[model samples]
Target: MSSSRAAVAGWALAACVYLLAQLHRTSLGVAGLLAEQRFGIDAGQLSLFVFLQIGVYAAMQIPTGVLVDRYGPRRVLVAAATIMGGAQLVFALVPLYPVALLARAALGFGDALTFVSVLRFAATHFSPRRYPVLVALTGMTGTVGNVAATLPLALLLRHVGWAPSFLGAGALSLVAGGAVALLLPDSTPPPRAVRTAAELRSGVLSIRGRVRRAWALPGTRLGFWTHFTSMSTGTALAVLWGTPYLVTAVGFSTAGAGAVLMVGVIAAAVVSPVLGWLIGERPSVRVPIGFGLSIVVVLGLVLLVTAFGDTPPAGPVVVFFVLAALGGPVSMAAFALARDYNHARSLGTASGVVNVGGFVATVLIALGIGWVLDLQGGTTARSLRWALLVAVAVQGFGVVRMIVWWLRVRATALHRQQRGEPVPVSVVRRRFDLRVTGPTGESGPGD
Candidate 1:
């Protein structure tokens, strides 16, 4: 196959691996009640499962990114698939709660590998112009897994029982691992010259400093807060608390809650391509677009908290969920921003750093909700409302951080332009007058 074909084939397999990762990540949401019954745990213990999983996932991000950069996606993705597959199977068969928690941690560690690797694959294989759409598509496809975790997994748990349903999911993951191992073509990194042993030791010692440098870049920091501000609310909802909140708090039936959560996932999936196209066409507006989306999300959260507090009627609640879901697509702009700001050598590291934002927020928000519920002594509508307020507060903080970073980056870009240095296309000033001529006395593309 041609290189382009090979890259496409490789990414297709990677996307499948990502699908399974998301499925494993969100599986607990639908299974919360079943988990509580089977493991004899309360809301706090149930939240611990996701908290531990996401914590491990968050902790593994930098290391996994380093591995992906050093080795490439094939090795990392294959290993991730195998570990997650095995972890899920163990989660299914194990009866002990402690053992189950270990399985979740393992799953989280494995899950961490899939997303950044898939992103690295896209970055390595595709043209820069194509990347925004590809990134959005990757996110959209992963939400299919989230949808599966909802109604389908719930139905399977109800009919086939927990062990068999999870065992089947695990088996599917193993098959996906095999496919990735066999079919995924690794990206070639720039060649490195042989170095002295002393030099190698010095390099190892400076790895932390190098990471710090990557974080210092304005674009990478922008990416981080972009992901931070845009993704956490929906992620916190979809991956752990949304279903329970709907059922236990808002009083939806199991199936009804699942359907509502499914709508949010589906809405995100549907909106992603449009956002991708818009970002591709007007890269300069990326931050503004993200800010707009964040505003919408904040509005939705405020409405949910103030208007729908305890007994939310379904229609307005669905609209609020859809608005929250739209944030996922908007967050894809962060990866594009990261790509523009960083070099290829550290792309994986930058991506890893950017990827951490949302999950970190999600972990804190999920755990906070659980803690609040525990303090309230049970899952009541009022307690759930209070828990959701935690999400609102966190999101509000993120929006402020995003705005601050965006201003800093924009100023830096302007300063660089003033010095006559080449900068990213997105930051260039556009001339609105169609008749305006460049120094060459001809209309430029910007005109």
Candidate 2:
């Protein structure tokens, strides 16, 4: 097979691993009521489950990145799939609440490895020009997993009971793992000179310095904040609370809520390619597009919160959900941004730093909503409405931070360009219609 074909096949298999990760992460949302019934947990305890899962996932990002850098994506992906499968199997069978909590924590640790590995693998194999679209496509594939978590998983839980349903989900992971082990191409890292034992130890001790350096890059910080502002609302809603809110607050039946969430996933999938193309063709618009989508998200939340006390009309509710779904695509620009700012060697670490932003926001918002709902004493429409206000507030804070960072980074890049230092082509803003000669003196589009 051609190298490009091999890369595509390997990436597809890796994306399958990501699909399962998404399913595992979001599966709890669909199973929330079932989990509460089985474990006899209240709102606070249920939120604890989500909190631990997301918290562990967030905590593991940097380590997972370092491991990927050291061991390569093939090993990391295979191990991730195995661990997630085992965790899900334990979650399916465990009778005690504590055991179930441990199972989710294990799942989170494994889930953390999939996305960055897949992204790192893509960065290794693909050209820089194609990275944005590839990232978006990878995200779009994961949305399918999210959709499956909704209707299909819900139906399985209804008919086969929770244990059988989750057992089947676990089995899928093992199958994906086996495929990755057998078929995924292991890319060899570029050769490095052998170092003395003392040198290796010094390198290990200086890991913090490396991370600090990556974090200092304006583009890296911009990517982090971009992810932070773009994905928090969607992640919080889709992964933990969207279904419950729709069912309890919007007056939809369980199936009705599942259908709506599924629609939102579909909407995200549809728009992802467009967003990717826009970013790829005109990198200058990356921040603007994310900023615009965030504004729409804030507006949607405002409208939803305002209409919450009275039953919200279905049209407005559906539109709000669709806007929420757009977050995933917009946040994906962060990966491209990270790629532009860092070298391939530190791409994993930079990506990890960028990845942390959304989930951290997600953890806070999900927990905050649960706390608010608990404070109000029930999951009624009024309580859920007030709880959703937390999302609006969090999103507003993110937008402000994003604007501040965007201006800072843009100015830094413009100044650096004025000084004649080479910057990544993607970071250099240019007109859409500008034509420039390449190094070979062939005229074409310019950044």
Scored by CA lDDT, what does every candidate get?
0.82, 0.83
Give model 2's TM-score versus the native structure. Answer: 0.92
Return the clash pairs for model 1, or none: none
Encode model 2's per-residue lDDT on 102-189: one tens digit a residue. Answer: 9999999999999999998888888877888889999999999999988888888888998899999899999999999899998657
Score residue 155 of candidate 2 by CA lDDT. Answer: 81
After best superposition, candidate 2 residue 203: deviation in angstroms? Answer: 4.2
Q: Model 2 clash pairs? A: none
Segments of candidate 1 deviating more than 4 angstroms: 1-3, 189-203, 426-447
TM-score of each: 0.91, 0.92
Give residue 318's error in model 2 in angstroms.
Answer: 1.4
RMSD per candidate (Å) reads 5.2, 5.1
